[model samples]
Target: MLLTLLWTLQGWVYLAVVFDLYSRRVVGWHMDRKMETSLISRALMMAINLRKPPPGLMHHSDRGSQYASNQYQAMLKQHDLVCSMSRKGNCWDNSSTERFFSSLKREWLTGNLYSTRESAIADVRAYIAYYNARRLHTTLGDMTPIEFEKIA
Candidate 1:
């Protein structure tokens, strides 16, 4: 998903986030002034480095141009990740990512605008930390992602 920041000196900063479904955690993210294929690729690389899932791991996303690009597809193949795209016009297929974006805006970025891309990055970094380590999730039986992982 893309998080757009307006009113910055550089015009717009876009954030690409990769959410892990098992623990509902944001395993990877990248922010830049442009929404390019490299942005998504970088985010996926972060997740791959962090989790290092086994071969044939399933990666699902909407049919965004960035995800559909040849470069992005090549990266997936290199990592032995199988790609799964949501059916056209179906939002429910990626509800976990959608919910994360909703919570990010409502709980972390509501009514506030960052003056710089650096500040936005800091804010998002802090929120992801809190969301993973402190915030309770009903889906995880009211435990945080880190906590659930520890016990699982």
Candidate 2:
């Protein structure tokens, strides 16, 4: 399952887990509040537009109504992406996504609070950019997500 983490302030910022199946790189992401269809929809659209993952990619997420919603399922169907839903009350199946959230909270969220959502949004946006571009991942051989993707 993906974590739709929001930076609480004037406008919320979201960090999507456009997590890859091979390198586990985050290919697409967006920052937004509302947590409505648009937030995740935008993330998925960006990931598809940019990565063009050769179709039939598997997209997994928890049973949040957002992920299981009709609109989400329809979009996946249109994209020919496989939708894998975690079982009820079970988070183990989505440990990777969960771990990402844990790291985010431990490293960032716990450090500060934003008076406005916009401030939070900005901070989270920078964090995600660094994460995908510069942060090294031991799992990916000390390569950033973008780096690993390039090497692959």
Best by lDDT: 1
Model 1 lDDT vs. the true structure?
A: 0.83
Residue by residue across 1-152, what tens digits does model 1's lDDT show?
43344345546777788888888888898888888998888889899999998999999988989899999999999999999998999989888777777788789888777788788778878988999899999999999999998988
Lowest lDDT block of 10, candidate 2: 1-10
- TM-score, every prediction: 0.93, 0.85
- Indicate which candidate wins on TM-score: 1
Can you write out model 2's per-residue Cα lDDT over 21-115, one digit (the tens) per residue? 56655666666666666667777888888778667778887787778789988988999999888889986888776766676677867868788
For model 1, the run of ten residues with the poorest summed lDDT: 1-10
Q: Cα lDDT for residue 64, model 2?
A: 75
Q: Which stretches of candidate 2 lie over 4 Å from their true place?
A: 5-15
